[model samples]
Target: MRADRLVSLVLLLRRRGRLSAATLARELEVSTRTVLRDIEALSAAGVPVYAERGRHGGFALLPGFHTELTGLNHDEALALLIAGSRRGAQAFGLGSALASAMLKVVDALPESHRDIAAGAAERLLIDPEIDLLSRRVADEEVPGTIVAEVRRAVFAGHKLRIHYTAAGRPPQWRTVDPIGLVTVRDRGYLLATRSGADRTYRLSRILAAEELDEPAERPDRIDLDRAWQERSTRFRAGGDQVTVLVRLNPARQEELLDTALAVRAEEAGSDGRLRLSVTFQDSRHAEWALWQLGTDAEALTPQWLRTSLRDRAAAIAARYEPP
Candidate 1:
């Protein structure tokens, strides 16, 4: 770990020129004293690192000195390229940085592997602004300034205040202790707590944000994955869940499961259709998913849901019949 930190310190100075110990500590999530020790270690290892003293003093690498530790194998380089292709980074306001880093990674590769890797990456495409199906998935509008403020608060362990608007509600301001930020499928969320109660806020819906002077009330160490999972499980179980029994074409089974919350049971009908018992978010959710399947699926139980689908289909049929 210490060796990795020392190498990173050298690379940082090489790339960004002079930087203060305080800045290095913030970037490395360590203390200024630790950064000073690492600088000493790098110099002791003949890295040509030097410190400038006085009011505007910091650490820097000698001119023309560069670290040779950016040697990534072909597969590793390709993986980085694939990660760079994702749109998630753009949602979190790191799009330009990601692009710049990818360029540096490509430039640092050896000549033999460089052309092949770059060409191969070109063949792969992801998260296009517009897809072939003509589905207009425009990027979610997350204010860069607000996102930056929230990020600083999250990383610096400062409390945050945000003006958020929930769906079908008026915008309101609230103070929260931000635990972390999560971005999934190009959407960003602030996982936080307000007055000791867990709250999740959509970043696109945050009209304004301010980082408070007070420290965030959160644990010093956090297991983000575990916390996210726990929150997700509780959310899924808390909604008005409904169980649905349906008969669907065998070929369309995958489609039904894709929209379902859970598949409680599955069995094959004598006629080769699939009998599926699934859970959905609610009655409206079940109705909508089944309607999309058209004649390929039929609801079997819960007369209300069956009636809802029938009414919707009849409404559509009425529109075209003799009108």
Candidate 2:
């Protein structure tokens, strides 16, 4: 990351002013030769880095030469750093560009506030794969080339042909009028229309993509949020959705909510636990979610679920019984 080192070198000179090559090497943790090379690179890139020849002389930027971060305050700069580092940014194939931009963002910030903003961003964590239950989150694999092609089609307003494989379905070629792209929970989706019907294709399932030269026959103006919302509404409406009544330890409530479609009703009981109605995609989904809570949750109305958990627990207990 010579580029990062170069940015650091400039920041150091901008902050401290006229530090010797040895000092820049110490701060950048690189050899003085590397520091000199970076200074040369910066100067070549029109960064106005000049070296003075004397015992006290060192590298420094021209006076009053700085890149303001568009008046971004400390918090705003911190937010940009955090957002740029999210793995979800990779969903749209912007990882490299985002990294470069974020570096530039830090580079452009006022020198006095720059270090503090960069340090603060390091303290915040977002979207780690492992949860409190130690279950690793799903990270779907998607080819960068396919995403790049799909992104081109979506932004260029061109037709896209994709060899898409829907779950439990064979890969089939679909030509879609690209509308927009959306990334939810680290999964990328292309929102398009086929013959005027809405179609959403997951990026991971796209085995191949070809951007057609023909322009997309999509609405000139679209409310992407509204379109995605309608599709989500339809998807939830069409599923074998089931609502379950359950009681769970308040501490485990988040775990249940993570697996649920939505919370229909909730009540905090006298026992300091939650009694609630929650929806899942189906009965199996509801049963599986409750079972994960072990004794921390109880299925109140779903008798079959209770029986299922009871039978599962009994079988486990029986296996551990003494001979």
Candidate 3:
């Protein structure tokens, strides 16, 4: 409402010292005319607001003026409580810190919102260990010391040396310009540049870490999200990408989707099965996903895949033949 907006306008001016009318409107998500009116309203309400008439000025609040606003509203309080309860905080080794902050938040909330927010937050769960299929989610384990060392380097903008082991490769020590850390799907990754090339390492695969004294050589500003997206796009487009058509049991649709690189098209068959065209990184990837479904999915094309499945099934049957 206007009261909240006025309070926000005062707070913005207080924190920023001085801001242009256009800037205030943009920050408050209102129009310049509305900002002017809010400024007049604040002045009329005995607030020490003043305007600096100049090509480079708009509005300012007199120094030493402050308002004692109460804590957040109910929705804001509940949203923060719910977000703080997520596992993402634990991935960054901030579980204890997050717990402490949550306590402060609960205590600072208006008495009417405190109990309700906490109770509502308690009923929410995010990223549970066990999925709907009864399969346990595997949480990748990384040593706290290793994570702390890498985290220190990332924030300090220093070079770091790490003993890293890629899949099917022996551990090797490499010095890298540390960029930042990212956590997705309950796993952590270190995004950095190796030998001037973008490299992402799974935190679980980092055996040891050492922060170097030399400052890292990197751009002053980085768009980490865009960088990650570009790398992910390159990765998905790499390798012998393959697309396969399959008819899968409707009940197992999620399983197929979870394993495929991407879904191209999907439709329901007259037989009640789900017909889907899915892409995988390669033939091996396609076979792995289809095989996981066993008899629940049938690969409809790439005669070679059909023959491979048939031969594999025959061998399995022979192995279990009555003796």
lDDT of 2 at 181: 78
Model 1 misplaced stretches (Cα beyond 4 Å): 1-85, 109-116
Candidate 1 per-residue lDDT over residues 1-323, each given as its tens digit: 89778878887887888999999999899999999888888878898989899888999989988654265543344335446546766666666656665777778778977999988989977777777898878779887799889978998999999999998899999999999977766788899999999888889999999999999999998888888888877876877898989999999988988888789999999998999999898888999899999999999988999888888879988998984
User: What is the lDDT of every predicted structure here?
Assistant: 0.84, 0.84, 0.85
At residue 59, candidate 2 shows an lDDT of 81
Error of 1 at 170 (Å): 1.1
Off by over 4 Å in 2: 1-85, 106-137, 268-273
Question: What is the lDDT for 308 in model 2?
Answer: 84
Top-TM-score candidate index: 3
Per-residue accuracy of model 3 over 103-151 as CA lDDT, tens digit each: 7677877898898998898998867889999999887878878987997
lDDT of 2 by residue, 1-323 (tens): 88778877878777888899999899989898888888888888999989898888988899998865565554344335546446666777766656665777778778987999988989987777799999998877887788888877887899999999998899999899999877787888889899999888889899999999999998889998899999988877777888889988999988898888888899999999899998888888888899899889999977877888889899999999999
Q: Give the range of the ten consecutive residues with the poorest summed lDDT in model 2.
A: 73-82
lDDT of 1 at 309: 85
Q: How accurate is candidate 2 locally (lDDT)?
A: 0.84
For candidate 1, the per-residue lDDT at 296 reads 97
Provide C-alpha RMSD values for all models, in order.
10.4, 12.8, 5.4
> Which is superior by TM-score, 2 or 3?
3
Comparing 1 with 2 on TM-score, the higher-scoring candidate is: 1
